[model samples]
Target chain A: MEPFIRLTAVAAPLLTPNINTDVLIRVEPMIKVPKGKLGPYCFEAWRYLPDRSENPDFILNKPAYRSAKILLAGLNFGCGSSREPAVWALADMGFRCIIAPGFGDIFFNNCFQSGMLPIVMPVETVEKLAKLAQSQGDLAPDFTVDLERQVIVTPSGEDIAFRIDALKRRALLDGLDDIGVTLAAKAKIDAFQANDLAQRPWIYRY
Target chain B: MAASTLFEKIWTSHVISDLGDGFALLHVDRHILHDLNAMKSLVELRERGYAVRNPELTIATPDHGVSTLPGRNIDTVPEGAALLRGYLEETRRAGIRSFDMNEDGQGIVHVIGPELGLTQPGTLFVCGDSHTCTHGGLGALGFGTGRSEVIHVLATQSIYQKKPKQMRINFNGTPGKGVTAKDLILYLIGQIGADGGNGHAVEYAGSAINAMSVEGRLTICNLSIEFGAKVGMIGPDDTAYDYLHGRRFSPAGANWDRAIAHWKTLPTDAGAKFDREIDVNVANVGPQITWGTSPQHVISVNDVVPDPATAGDAARRDAMNGALDYMGLTPGQPIAGTPIDWVFIGSCTNSRISDLREAGAIARGRKVKPGVSAWVVPGSQQVKQQAEAEGLHEVFKQAGFEWREPGCSMCLAANGELMPRGQRSVSTTNRNFEGRQGPGARTHLASPSMAAAAAIEGAITDVRKMMV
Candidate 1:
């Protein structure tokens, strides 16, 4: 996991809400491909035609947005499926930030583990960002997502506030995944397990 | 102290450390893994040099990425062999208990955990698959995790987490004829929309829930992730206890008594406050069929397709229009007569023995419509054998429905069992997300009996009309 304090990059607009994990990373059965090799398959069903040619209409396929590092999306982004490849694909595509009205519960949690910033902004703020991206059309616009400040700075100099808990904020700044956090609490966890084993021995009988 | 919701009660007892800001280090009582997605996490763990903290607490099976064909080996499908071999190798290396293909206990992760008694009341469980919430039918705090979190759990036997707010959905009336727990959940998702349960753990309650069988409860809780909830549960009761009494992994003798005593206290306290509440009357919730892309786009089987112009907002209208365009349906058309090219009767959602019996009853003496493909993939090896022993397989076979071995077959289309492009299907699976069943596949999510009813008539037929 990489530390994500701040990122200023082109933001691709995918206005459709409920953009699910299956769309984010199409599941290919029998393909033993690793997660790092999944970027090309991100949104494969939607991003490409049956002939294996890129769908010219998809925003990510356009020349200006091809290198987008931020994704500005609509409500309920990353819904459906617990596949972490959805997060992996976005990170592999160099997207460090995802701004949306909200995100699916598991997807939101998965982002922190991968050091991707999933920012939840007000619907009005998201709509505003969407409008900005749309107005730019094929020309991708740059946005600044500052995790330290907990704000998204639009291209037009507006600072939109977003809320993230102090714990997640620290995790992002420190590039700490869940394992790192758990390892840090090693003493406490060991103590709890010792106490729990004494109290509930049957649970460990497996 | 205030009365605690069922979620808070279960969550509080598992907290190992309070990280503040609502986050905690929560212990996981059980962790489940499957062949399709577990290898990546295992590889990462190996790279990190972390041995599993307690291999005894974890279980692995080949479910999501294996062929469900009878006598199917990894070579049955191009990728099937490698996926199965990987599962066997990784589980062997990690020392975690695994049920390989053709094994006695091999099944969908969600189905096997409860059937084997690994999912008990008041404990927290996590799995790589989203439908793990099915365990919550027994009052466990079961939910899905991504590959990275799976690695963390294998390493520490716990997960870093923030507690979710709680939601309680109570259904008061008895279901009418032909309605099942699948219908109840589809109706709820349609009522609340796909994102309505976001950020909350939902506990199903009221009279309607209490009357349901454990299998039905599992069906309802299985779709919790479809509506954005991470955890969905039903408080354990005598029904749940009866279901778990003699399962292979269940406690015996005095241990059983102690387990029962603890589980009896797992329900929500009286006057408990939930972050949100919704109440619906199930008497009017007839069989539900999703008419559009998302599960929220569902309507009663007897209702007409919705017009995009009638949507609440522009975004919703666009969503409806896109769905209509993709699904090839017309506004104000009756959903009952909408043609379906395929009917699928299995998934973690509705693939238990009772679910199979319902489908079998409908398929008996009825021929499948010409050019319509119908298939029944049982949820587990146990379900498959039981259905076969009971002659349910013959009923389906006689009715022109293909009876396949259990796993997540048509539900994901990851194995070679996808519906043809532009073909609309009435499926017993959870999500109907575009291309969910396969590329260009149009799916209408429904109950098992409803799917069978469609198979017999070649279109989306009202299951109530077929009911005797």
Candidate 2:
């Protein structure tokens, strides 16, 4: 995983709420491919026509947003299913930051594990950014996300401050996954287990 | 201190270390995994040189990627077979208990957890799949986690977490006749859009929930993920205890007494406070169904399809328009009698014996309408066997429905069973997202009985009208 301090990229707006993981990445029958190969299949159902042709109407198919590295999504983005492939697909597709009103809990955690930064801002701010992206028409301008400063800089120099967990910010900056985070408290865990064993032997019987 | 919410009582008790800023290193009582993500996660653990701290507390099963075709061998579904083989191999190497695809106890992780008595009251459980909230029906604090967290739980038997705000949703009054638990939940999601419960653990209380059977409670809890809740639970009562008294994995004798004593204390106290409270009166909630691409885009079976022109905002209007286009529905058209190509009555949400029985009763003397295909995929082998022994399968087969094996089939469309592109279906599954069943496959989420009634009518017909 790569540490994320700051990222500047064109923002693609998916203005729909509850864009679930199942849509972000189709539930794959063949999940055995290399991690990097998932980018092509991101949003497969919406990205492609029935005849296997690209759906040109999709935002990602537009010439300007084709290289987008930031996603300005609506409330409750990545809301259903716990597939980590959703994060893998987004990250593998070159998205570095996702700005939304909120996110599904598991998907938010998966983003950190995959080196993607998820920033939660007020819904009004996200709507403003989304409107700005729309006004750009075919040539969406790049936005800058600064994790250390907890702010998003719009094309017009408007700064949108976002709130993220301090611990999550540290994880993103350090590129530390949950394993690394949990293992940091290993000594405390062991001591708690010893105390639990002495006090509640029957609890572990099952 | 004032009385604590049921969520705080169970969650705070499991905290081994409190990290600053509302986060904690909480102990996990049981961890469950399934085929889709388990194989890769187990391999990662092995490569990290971290042995599973306690294999006894972990269990894996083949559910997501297996065929629901009767007498089907793993080779029948090649991709599914490969995934199952990987899970089998990895579980063996990791020394974790795995319920093989052919085993009687093997089923969807959520179904098997309760059937095998692994999901006891007041415990913390995590799974790789989002619907792990299904176990919260047992009064447990259960939620989904990511792959890294699953591996972390495997290595240390604990996962880093933050306590979620607690909310309570009370369904008062008796639900009208022919209204199932699925209808109640769908109605709730419709009332409060899909993300209504975001960032909160919800407790389902009131007379309505107390009157439900355990299977009914499970059905309600299974859809908690759809509402964006971290977890949804019903406090354990005699209904729960009676259901678990002599199950295959339940405690016996004096141990049972001790367990019951603790379980009795799992409910909210008289003065417990919740961050949010919602009261729903079920006096008029008809057999509910989704009419659009999202689960929250719901209406009663008798209500007409919503006109996008009535939407309060441009975004909502656009969403409704897109859904109408994808669903091939017209504005102001009645939702009833909307033609459907398939009927699916399975998934963790509604595949238990009681669900099957409801579907079976609806299909008992009626044949499926022409051009409509119906399938009943049981939640587990035990559900399948019980349905067969009770002649439910014979009834379904006689009514032009296929009685399939146990696994998540059309629910995800990941397995071979899928509704064709451009086809419309009435499903008992939790999700109705665009292309959820398959690319361009339109879905109407409903109860099992409703699915059965649709199969017989070849359209989204009202189950209440069909009840005899």
Candidate 3:
């Protein structure tokens, strides 16, 4: 996992609410495509036309947003399915941060696991940023997401505060392997299990 | 301790250590896996030189990627063969129990867990599939994990989780006849948007929930993820106890008595406070169905499609218009009587023996309408055997509905059993996302009986009309 500190890049605006994981990466490629090679399959339904050509109408396909690393979306982004590959697909497609009004709980957690940042702002705030990105097009100023400071520097040079779980922020900043950290407390876990077994033997008997 | 909700009790009992900032290292009591990511996680664990911490507590099956076609094998779906084979090999290598293809206990992970008594009250269950919340019907704390979390659980048998806020939704009245649990949940999602339950652990309560069968409760909990809640549960009662009394993995003899005593104490105490509360009176909700893409885009069968022009905001109007266009629906047209090309009567949400029987009751002496291709895929091999033993298969077969093997067939179409592009289907699945059945294939989410009625009429017909 790559450590996320600060990133400055163009932001693509896709303001549709309830953009689910199934739409991020469909089931077929999700099963067959291996990790890190899913860039082409990310958002296959909306990214491509009926004939498999790039859908120029899609914001990501537009020349100005082709190299975007930030995504601005609407409510309930990444809802449906616990597929982690949806985050992988977005990462593969070069997106490192997603800004939305809200997110599905599992998807929100999955983002932290993948070293990607999911920022929640007020719906009106996101819409305002999206409008700025859209109205400026090719000349849209690059936005900067500074994780250590917990703020998003908008194109207009305004700093917007955000919040993330402290432990999650620390994990992302250090790119720490969570399992290794948890395994360090094996003694504690073992002790808990031993005590629990005495209290509830039926749990272990099964 | 003052008062505690069932969620708090279960969560506190499973806590290994508090990592602070509302996070805790949770001890996973039961870890379930399926074909999609379990084998890959196990193989990765091996590559990392880690062994499964508690293989005895882990169970696996091949459901997500296997074909449901008759005479199916690992190779039945060519893309899924490698996954099925890897699952068998890895589980065997890791000393984990796996209910393989055609095995008596093999079926969808959520269905088989409770059916085989692997799910119990007061236990914390985790799985790689989101619908693992279905086990919450047994009064367990169940939620889905991502692939990395699966590997973490395999290595440590513990996971880091931030405790969620609690929300108790009370269904205060009895549902009208023909309005099933599926309709109740769909109505809840429709009333509150898709993200209504976001960031909360939901508890279903009140008279309506207490009166439902265990299978109906499972159906209600199975779609919790669809409504943006990762954890949903119902407190266990005599119905749950009776359902698990003699199952394969359930405790017997003295253990059963002790287990019941512990489970009896797992319900919420009087005066327990919740972060939020929602009261629903289900006395008038009809058999609900999705008219457009999202689960929130649902209405009673008697209602007409909503016009995007009435939407409060531009973005919402655009989304509604896009959904209507993809679904091939007119704004003012009735959702009922909309022609459908296919009917799929199975999925994790509604594929138990009871669900099959409901569909069978509607199909007993009727024929599927011409030009409609209908299929009934059971949730598990046990469900299939039980349905067959009860002659439900004959009822469906005689009505021109295919009686296929057990797997998640036509629900997300992972097994290559998808409806063709441009066709519309009435599915007993949890989702109606655009192209969920197939690319350009529209879906109307409904219950098994509703899907069966659509199969007979070749359109979205109100199940109540046939119920009378």
Candidate 4:
């Protein structure tokens, strides 16, 4: 996993509510496409037309937003399925941050593992950012998300505060492997298991 | 100590250490895997030089990637053959029990867990699929985890989780005639938008929930993820105990008596407080179905497509318009009588023996309408055997419905069984997201009997009309 510190890039605005994981990457490509190779298949349904040509109407397909690294979205973004490939697809496509009113719980957690930041902002605030991004098109000023400072620097030079779980923020900053950290507490886990076995014998017997 | 809710009690008991900031390292009692995710974790563990911490507590099956065709083999779905083979070999190498496609215990992970007694009250269960919450119907704390978390569990048998707030939804009255658990849950999802239960662990209570069969409770809990709750559970009672008695992995002899005593103390105590509460009168909710891309775009069968012009806000209106265009639906048109080309009567939500029986009752004397391809894929091999012995298969077969083997067929379309593009289907599956069944395959979610009725009429028909 890449360590996330600070990033400055163009932001694409897709204001549709309830953009589920299914929309991020369909099931066929999710199963068949290997990791790091999912960039071409991201949002396949909306990204491509019936004849396999790029859908010109999609926000990401527009020339102004083709190189965007940030997504400004509406409520309940990534709301369906626990498929982690959805996050992989977005990361593969060069997306490093997403600003939405809310997010599905599992998808929210999956983002940190892939070095992608999911920020929950007020609906009004997100809509305001999206409006600004849309109004400027290719000339839209690049937005900066700084993890250490825990703020998003908007195109208008205003700093918007955000909060992430302290442990998660640290993990992302350092690109720490979680399993190695947990395995360091082997003694504590073994002790807990030994004590628990006596109280719930049936759990082990099964 | 103060009184505790069912979720509180289960969560407290499973905690190994508090990592602070509302996060804790939890001891997982059971870990179930399927072909879709097991191989990834196993390969990662091998690469990292870590053995499975507790192979005895882990079990696997090939469900999502295998075909449901009669006498199906790993190669039946050629695209998924490598995954199925890798899953079996890895589980065998790790000394974990794995049920193959032809095995008696093999089925959808959620279905077989409860059927084989691997799920029990007061246990914390984790799986790779979101519908793992189905085990919570048996009074367990079940939730889905991602691939990295799967590897974490394999190596340490523990997961770090931020405790979720508690919410209880009470179904206070009896369901009306022909209204099933599927309808009750769908109605709730419609009431509370798709993300209403986000970040909360939900508990189902009151008279309606208490009166439901265990299978019905499973159906209700299976869709918790669809509504944005990772965990959904019910307090175990005599119904759950009766259902688990004498099953394969259930406690026996003296262990049964002790296990029951512990489980009896697991329900919420009087005066326990929840962060939020919602009460519903099940008597008023009719058969429900989705009309759009998301699960929350639902209404009773008697209602019509809502006009986007009348929506409360511009965002919602745009969403409604997009859904209408994709579904090829006209505003103000009745949801009922919408033409459907396929009827899928199986999924983790509604593919149990009871679900099959309900669909069989509707299909017994009616033939599927011409040009509509209908299929009844059982939840598990055991469910299939039980349905076959009860002659449900014959009824479906006689009614022109294909009675297929057990797997997660067409639910996620992982096994290559999918409805063609530009078609519509009435599916018993939980999700109705865009392209869920296939590209351009519009789906309307409903109960098994409702799906069966749609097959017979070649359109979306109210199941109540054919209940008798």
Indicate the residue-level lDDT of B208 in model 1: 93
* Structure candidate 1, residue pairs in collision: A30-B79, B74-B81
lDDT of 1 by residue, B248-346 (tens): 888778788888988887799999999899999999898999988898989999899999999877777877888898788999999998888999999
DockQ of each: 0.71, 0.65, 0.81, 0.80
Best by DockQ: 3
Q: Which stretches in model 1 have alpha-carbon errors above 4 Å?
A: A29-31, A135-138
Summarize candidate 4's per-residue lDDT along B228-280 as a digit string, tens digits.
99999999999999999999999999999999999999999999999999999
RMSD of each: 1.5, 1.6, 1.0, 1.0
* lDDT of every predicted structure (CA atoms): 0.87, 0.87, 0.92, 0.92
- The TM-score, computed over Cα atoms with residue i paired to residue i, of candidate 3 is 0.99
Worst 10 residues of 3 chain B by lDDT: B73-82
Candidate 4 lDDT at A169 equals 95
Q: List native contact recovery per candidate, as a fraction of 1.
A: 0.64, 0.60, 0.72, 0.72
Compared with the true structure, what per-residue lDDT tens digits does model 2 show for residues A7-124?
8889998877788898888886237555778888888877888887999998888888988999998878999998888898888778989989889877987888888998888887
Residues B1-468, model 2: lDDT tens digits: 778777888888789888889998898888988988788888888888777887877888888888988898788788678778888898888788888888988888888988888888888899988998999898989999878888889989998887788889999999887899999999999988888988889999999999999999988888888889979998999999988888877777767888898888778998898999999998879999899988899999999999999987776788889889999999999999888899999999999999999999999989999889999999999898999999999999999999888999899988767778889999999999888888888999999999999999999898888886
DockQ of 1: 0.71
What's the lDDT for residue A160 in model 4?
92
Query: Which is better, 1 or 4, measured by TM-score?
Result: 4
Q: Give stretches of model 3 more than 4 Å off.
A: A135-137
